[model samples]
Target: MATITLTVNQAIRELSDIDPTTPLLWVLRDHLGLVGTKFGCGKGLCGSCTVHLEGVAVRSCTMPLASVAGRSVTTIEGLAGEGDELHPLQESWIEQDVPQCGYCQAGQIMSAAALLNGNAKPSDDDIDTAMSGNICRCGTYQRIRKAIRAAAEKGGAA
Candidate 1:
């Protein structure tokens, strides 16, 4: 067991006595109770467990708690406006009707947020390339792309 400290959703968390090899997905969902990050393949192939490791998108299921020692992690629950205002992407997602089953939405949103952070005015190809890893069984790719573009244009993210 190892003690690890990390910044999650801008809050510092100190976890004492935990297996280092345990996947971050379990730590977030099981320990911290941040269930927004879904469990999909439980492997690196699926991006359902995507989260931001120091502002970079990564698969939490394959990442061990030991590796994220002092990094800032952002989950779906953390990606939003200050309060009930709703993030631009969140609003655009709803406006565009981007969710089907909603199982993959958290990963989708996390991936999209990363993309927008780097490239605010991403083209269709950029969106395609950045979001390619996330798999949505509902196949709402077109709508997802549209919502991203809309959010970018509407100044949804600063």
Candidate 2:
């Protein structure tokens, strides 16, 4: 066990007597009260617990809290641009009606945001490669893809 301070959503959060081995997902959801990063599979196979570590998407379920002590973390709740200003992917999501169960949408968007941060114009193959880890039980893959493309076209991340 260790006392650690993590930078989350642009805020400094000090956690006392925390287990460093604890997965980041539980820390964010249970400790930090950032529940938008859902818990689907504890094995990290499902991307439901995906979040950004230094702007790169990672599986929060398997990531140790100790790994993020000095680094910054961004959950789905922090994806918005500014007050009441949604990220381009968020706007496209609403415009495209992408969510069905909505359980995996946050993770999907986080992963897509990472992808878009690297590739402004992601090919279909790029989208598939990037989103292969995220599983949407509601079968909203098509809509997700469309929304991603739309966000890209609108210069969401770039």
Candidate 3:
């Protein structure tokens, strides 16, 4: 057991006396009380555990706590702007009716946020490629794409 420190959602967090090899998913969900990053397919294949590591999308389930030491991590809870203002993509999501079951929406939104961070105006192909890793059993791919495009138009990427 050891201590590890990292930035989470712009806040410095220190985890003590924990196994460094533990998956970051557990640390975020169980230890840190951030349940927005869900658990699905324990393996890294499913994007349900997606979060941002240094502004890049990553699967928290397979990412070791040690790997995130001294790194910046962003979970769905941090996706919103200050004062709990919804990110543009989030507003677009509601406008587009993107979620059905909503179980996968957080990860889906996180992945979309990363894409928008890099490409303010992404093509349909780009959206498809960036979102291919995430799976929505509700089959809301079309809505997802539309939401991304709408958010881009609203300067969500900026």
* TM-score (all chains, Cα) for each model: 0.97, 0.98, 0.98
Model 2 lDDT per residue over 1-158, tens place: 89989899999999899999999999999998999999998999989999999999999999999999988999889999778999999999999999998999999999999999999999999999999999999999999999999999899793
lDDT of each: 0.91, 0.94, 0.94
Alpha-carbon shift of residue 42 in model 1 (angstroms): 1.4
Candidate 1, residues 37-119, lDDT tens digits: the string is: 99999978879999988778899999999999898999989888687777789999999999999999999989998998888
Colliding residue pairs in candidate 2: none
Model 1 scores worst on lDDT over the 10 consecutive residues at 79-88
Which residue window of length 10 is worst by lDDT in model 3?
149-158
Candidate 2 contains a number of clashing pairs equal to 0
Mind sharing the TM-score for model 1? 0.97
Clashes of each: 0, 0, 0
TM-score between model 3 and native: 0.98
Q: Model 1, residue 26: what's the lDDT?
A: 95
Better of 1 and 2 by lDDT: 2
In candidate 1, stretches whose alpha carbon ends up further than 4 angstroms from where it belongs are none
Clashes in model 3: which pairs?
none
Q: What is candidate 2's CA lDDT for residue 27?
A: 96
RMSD of each: 0.9, 0.8, 0.8
Per-residue error at 16 for model 2, in Å?
0.6
